[model samples]
Target: MTEGMGDKTEGAERILCDEGLRVAVGGLGDRVVVDVRDGTANRFWTDTSNLEKALHGEAVRIDAHGGYCVIEVREGTGRLDLVMEGVEHKHCDFSTGDLADAIAMVREQSDPEGSLVERA
Candidate 1:
């Protein structure tokens, strides 16, 4: 729902944000893709159909290319629970009040050096 992404329709992909970082969402069936590009050749992404369900505290985890990301709703507060394996063996945890904050958290971690600012 970020600015310029427009209203989401059934099965439509949208680029949520593409500033110092790029985040896009799309897919269908039991799949929802959240692709994050930190302005590097390497990218970090996740796809899961359980996101909506997970917002009720049902934790979901996905592993990819020697790393992993987890998403769930925080108990009690119902906040978004996002945990990911970051660069150089870093384990990052983000408890965001909403999806936008979650995306921002990812952008900050994925591009900690602000390398994408110039390209953006």
Candidate 2:
């Protein structure tokens, strides 16, 4: 399980894993942004609406890298679980508040319009 770290943005907290993955959590409109990254690539698996559903105890699946990824937010805790199944299986857990600030950084560094589509 990942622990919450110091604040990384105005309303978000960030967590850095030793494997070089990062997660940031923050609000986006009425939904939450669970932004995950490996190096510079965003490996997010769900859209804002689906993320909201996950936060409400739903399991959401998305096609990814020729297979599929399952995303879910633990009930009442807001922790995110991402499980990728392809040639190999991978799992990541992001504590609540570890997926927000990166959205701001991504917005500022990339084209806002493109980021919108990327995050969607």
Candidate 3:
């Protein structure tokens, strides 16, 4: 779990699997694992360390049903071997400021806008 995780109620914990993949622990229950992406069923573990280097503000591919949701690591325990979320592209250098702002922007963009469709 990420640092200072257990302090918050109904909060998320940074979880690093033994295989080395990182995922935010949204919540835990019997036969139910909540992550940054809602309602994930297919879970996999890999020994790949590529995701461990992932840091706050870095993006990741959250595997779910049918498709995947691209998200950023909002927080993590800064460690060399810490397993973190895996994503496609990473440009920011794990800076705190960049991470925070980028995540905020992402959340804003994720909000639903009804049946409204965008053209071009």
Candidate 4:
């Protein structure tokens, strides 16, 4: 092995997204997981440390989905913000058993259909 060379991974990480939309969470640690085909306008502002890191440090961040909607959870923030950029943004205090809502969101967005979804 050459000096300063990292071991190359033969294949990218494969994710079993819900629905029919397949996606992967590359090098970024649960930071920006977007629909590659639909992420042309994607961008985000997150703390240097990622979600897990933020949680560990008790910090929060604001991010948009589809580069359009804002569906996110942050540390020390007792609210959920849903924003449809250039259209609307909503915010409300966290709700009961919200862990369910979160899981449901993941399932719907991950692979709402039954088909082959590739990693980008």
The prediction achieving the highest TM-score against the true structure is: 2
lDDT of 2: 0.42
How does each model score on lDDT? 0.40, 0.42, 0.29, 0.31
Poorest stretch of ten by lDDT in candidate 3: 1-10
Whichever of 1 and 2 has more TM-score, that candidate is 2
lDDT of 4 by residue, 2-119 (tens): 0111122122232323222232222222123322112232333332234233323333444444333223345544333333446344444432234333333333342223322222
Q: What's model 2's lDDT at 81?
A: 39
lDDT of 2 by residue, 1-120 (tens): 111212122333345333434555443333233445544333443444565455457776654343444556574344433444422344566543333333343233433332223322
lDDT for model 1, on a 0 to 1 scale? 0.40
When sorted by TM-score, best at the front, the candidate numbers are 2, 1, 4, 3
Taking all chains together, the TM-score of candidate 2 against the true structure is 0.44
Every candidate's CA RMSD: 12.6, 8.8, 14.9, 12.2
Record all residue pairs in model 1 with backbone atoms less than 3 Å apart, i.e. clashing.
none
**Model 4: residues with Cα > 4 Å off, grouped in runs:** 1-24, 28-41, 45-48, 57-59, 62-84, 90-120
Q: What lDDT is reached at residue 35 by model 3?
A: 30
Off by over 4 Å in 2: 1-46, 75-86, 99-120
Worst lDDT 10-window in candidate 1? 1-10
- Of 1 and 4, which scores higher on lDDT? 1
